[model samples]
Target: MSSTLLEVTRAAHEEVERLERIIVKDLQNEPATNKDRLFQSHRVRNMIETIMSTTHKLVEIYEDKDSARKDEIAALGGQTATGTNVFSAFYDRLKEIREYHRRHPAARVVDANEEHEALLKEEPVIEFTGEEAFGKYLDMHELYNQFINSKFGVPIEYSAYLDVFSQPHSIPRKLKLTRQYREYMENLLEHLIYFFQRTEPLQDLDRIFSKVTAEFEEQWENDNVQGWEKDVKESGQLPPQHTVIDLDYYSTVEELMEVGPDKLKEALVALGLKSGGTLQQRAERLFLTKDTPLEKLDKKHFAKRSHGSEQNGGAPALKEVDNSKEIALMEAKMKKLCDLLSETIVQTKENVVKKQALTYDEMEAEREEEEMQADTESDDEEQQIYNPLKLPMGWDGKPIPYWLYKLHGLGQEFKCEICGNYSYWGRRAFERHFKEWRHQHGMRCLGIPNTKNFNEITSIEEAKELWKKIQERQGLNKWRPDLEEEYEDREGNIYNKKTYTDLQRQGLI
Candidate 1:
């Protein structure tokens, strides 16, 4: 037993090490800026810490049990627990090494270009042929691949999309566009499909449904017992009081057909949609029936059953006209909706392109100015003052610029006071940080009294003040109930209390 436990413990330790390698490699591509790097480091720390803690607990339990079992084994025979002792000793040393590594900071992380530069120094370059549009396709493919790769830690290679486009089903049929457009569309679809496949698993859907039911049952078992009992009493498991018909009779098509059209007509007559005229006259009346009720026959069911009436050879002309008009009206509404949606999409795309063009111009201008400054500085030794503007602090003797301090403050201003990180990427991140915090804290603090300018923070002082206020409000060290209550209110307002509260305090809520 001791030896078996030792082997299991060793295996678990090895497994965690393997998992850690994968996690670290995945995070290598993340940006190494103040907030982003801080966040990535924190995330990696959390993952490693979790792995370490779990490993520790498992080792501790195994050792305790193994020692007791060894004593039992000693009583039984002369054989010693060498394997158990060796594994325990090894795990202890490994844990100590890991702890030391945790205490000592690692080398600073660098950007993707820097990392790629280091890699490309040894590797030979490959060449490819391309048309004019091929460049655009390649660019789009690379961008899409990068986005997915960074996000999900999944490799969606350019070759994979090329393979997809080469498939007979896609190339000769649906995506029969120019080669460049086909490849681009394939790449886009590849990303969408990859994400969808990752999210949607192949396990029995009923199992998920069962788990949901089990969770609901577990949650409501104690607290809602009396209510549940009352509900069961009021609504018994037997057939509903309104369900008077025999279910067995309705189960088979043969049984329904055996009832005959005459019997069905008589049943409908009993329900008050009968005409004073004969069966032919009633069929004619029912054809045009819209608001008329046949108590047990739903209007939808009546319309469906009326399809059989067409074969019965009555009111064929009336039925054809009704179906045609309904189809025509539906087609007209669909066309109008399509036009409206297309117009909205065109305007939205125009706005986005305009905004992107302006941003690109600004970035280009800044780059040119930076290049000019760099050239001038290289020419003159006196003006060698490195503008450590957006650079990380503690790089050189040059003191950290005022803007970085301001940016850090702005990043903090938007970061979750509870989580100490940005909520998500893109839109959700913006909504949580800028709209939620800045709006609540007072728009004047962000210097955007009326406008929605979240990306731009006005000054270093305002940013610093906001950051300080957030810390105070969150009661990081100081336990202020008033501020805590404010956090609670904001959490509720955003419909995200669980996200706002830490895990330890989550149970209390």
Candidate 2:
């Protein structure tokens, strides 16, 4: 569309030039002398012809200059009629600009206004030039970045960026968002891999980003997937990873009896065992599958068998399992593996569908269990939370170490009298609290403007006194022209304008 518009604009220029030439020719050939020949004088005709010729020359010159300009524009990639603003190269220029300035301390940085004025005067001036930060790399190569950005086609709107680059952690500019800019930190890291790929000098950085992003992906999976499996095992829903390490060893009746009742039931379900009764019954039910090695245990339940299952498919191979947790997490793992085997048994042996009715009591118990787990973790940090000052606990439900508390100046107390003697912990908090709701409310109650002058002044008396002094100063500084201006009498005695006026009216100087 822009190309079409540009072509039309070019053609319009040609048409206009052609029309102008035709109009000039018509005027010149119209003959200055009329049909009556009343103005047919040699000198007059010569004067009229000279004026028309000069006008024709001026028009030709304009056309030539315009053509030259068109060629220049075409050489630099023909002008696009659709361009609303200039595309600045931010990423390509900012680093170089900073480097140049840093290396050359004597180099003066010319601001935008100075550069504009110098250009207007056609004088040479060093101007700050940088390429605009356009996130084409993210929009193209990074899949997540591309996907998130595709949700909104508005890259920039209302004079603000509406894309991923406008997000909180955007490298270019981190400004308050006028619209929702949803994205994850890892996506930004992935996009940086290619962002630096374009920079020849930063090839090492390209490799670094690739390594970092890979590590991030692995860490995320470990945290989420493994954490979920651990939760399932803890809840007695599945057996732990290590216990399931050797499904064949636990197939015997003796091994089956070793697991607890709940685990035994779960094991029965996992091994495709459908029988249900006491703990011993569930165990005895699992013992029936002793001959069918863990490898072929599923064959009795299902007639069809895959070639791989018949060969190496005894169980799914786990990846990245930390086997070192075998001892400490044995009970959990035992329950986990048994539960998995139990599930396999029931699912394969029983055609009846299993249903789970929601248990509100169990949900409450689980919530309490999670809290208790956190409490247990806290206990590991210390036998008990010991703080004579009663410092606040961190998110982990344990008081922060004493050294850290002192480092943040949390040991020192600050009382804001204006805020009803509300206590604030640390200088930073004390400084910030002045602008917060409590302090603002206090200032409002005192009928004082929440100005910067009253920031450190917390006491009610001090604030009231300052307000009184401010009022007095303002009154003294108020515009009173009658008292401020002086009038000199004939005897050179000076009086205030108001008194002088009164005395003069009474004919007394």
Candidate 3:
């Protein structure tokens, strides 16, 4: 009985030693966060407590058995041995084991001073407050509203528009302008023009206004139009409409050149001229002489001019043409581009705000549901239950403490056969989790040392192959002088072979 008790105690001690080795190794190698260190410390403490309790019980049992045996020997007329108690040796061993643990504490369960230092090193989480979030949202909303109304001459209701924007599918659907509001504005413009025509003395006012409206409509059509109405109407099948440039306005080459390269290119391209060469080359080719007729210049003529220029080994020197009209046209185009860019920026900001508002709304709904569920649970006595292991939900509806996913192998896309088929979502997570404790444990269970490439192995066969290579390297290292040599000076400082050789050559050691 005494022998059996001793065996049990020894086995427990061995198990405790194994756990301690694992904990110490993890502490040395793993770059754990404060929370992770705390968890490891608690686990070690629990295991230690259980070992201590079991050893005490075993000692008690051994003492009782020893006492009974001594009594039986005395009753049988045999001289009772007065030597040292058998349980005393076990007690001494237990004390020594306890002392060893006391001297070498569990991983991250450091002395008070060390714990204080660790606490100081920990970073606090910064949470975004409701008031700050709402304030930012309101500011962005006002700016976006002002930009749209000022630029497009349309007013949007903030609350109503935000409701549509907050929908999860709204952004992908490309919800930009409201259809009813657009049609209303178009009709209003027409009504205003009619009213002005009846009230004013100008006879051709309506015709002038209609022409201006047509130009604006043409511009809108040519621009990259967003929203469902434009998409459903165009269907990406129709070719882009060309801008009609009345050639009658520009009677001379000088007047044509004043419109700038872009407008000049557009006019030439529309007129079926050869669309080759640089803007300057094309312009020079088309207007070779001041009296050259625009109708007379064709693709063949332009091609011939290009071939002639190439044969002559260089482009013909064209005269620099600059005018006030060209400068004015460039300025106008720049201003239009600026307006389009600003509108795009404003729309992008609006999308960001929509996303934020959607997240905020979802969080609020979740909070309310939790509160209601708590109330119902409180009303029921037997039915009320709590799960301490369940993690809290984040604002995005994911589990709080994101590392929990790694532990349970949840939300992962790839599974590794070597690590008990644990899943990893991305390459980063897969690589990072390989160095983690859970993965290392799996390797140990398979009787394989967790090498640098252990985490990278996807199958048991791969692990075995790597282990074989590692053993070969170890065997080679045993015979290698480079692996065995370590230099130490009189001050007991250790150095590698290269460093020691250099130091000795320099007489520094």
Q: In model 2, which runs have C-alpha deviations exceeding 4 angstroms?
A: 1-389, 479-509
lDDT of 3 at 374: 79
- Candidate 1, 1-509: lDDT as tens digits: 12344455666776577557645564666555533443344445455666888788676865786486465444334334453464555566567657766776673545655643443232222222241121112223464454344311235444343333222222121112223433444454454333222222222334544554465456444434211222212111122221212234454434444554565454344223442455444444443322333343444434433445547774753664344333323222323322323443344345445545676436644654675457556856556555434433347544344444344443233433322333433334445555555443544544434234323443445555766676678675775443344344424543243444653266634
Task: Candidate 1: list runs displaced more than 4 Å.
Answer: 1-68, 72-366, 380-509
Estimate, for each residue in 321-431, the C-alpha lDDT of model 2 and write its tens digit: 333122113222323322323433233223211112335445444554565466666736556654444767888876665555667899678999999999998988999
- A best-first ranking of the candidates according to their TM-score comes to 3, 2, 1
Q: Which stretches of candidate 3 lie over 4 Å from their true place?
A: 1-267, 271-353, 356-414, 424-447, 450-458, 479-509
Order of candidate numbers by lDDT, starting with the best: 3, 2, 1
lDDT of 3 by residue, 325-426 (tens): 222222233233223234433554575566567764365445555754675567565653443335446574433443443455544477888678877765
Candidate 1 global CA lDDT score: 0.42
Give the worst 10-residue stretch by lDDT in candidate 2. Answer: 172-181
Q: Model 3 — which ten-residue stretch has the worst lDDT?
A: 317-326
The CA lDDT at 482 in model 3 is 58
TM-score for each prediction? 0.20, 0.20, 0.25
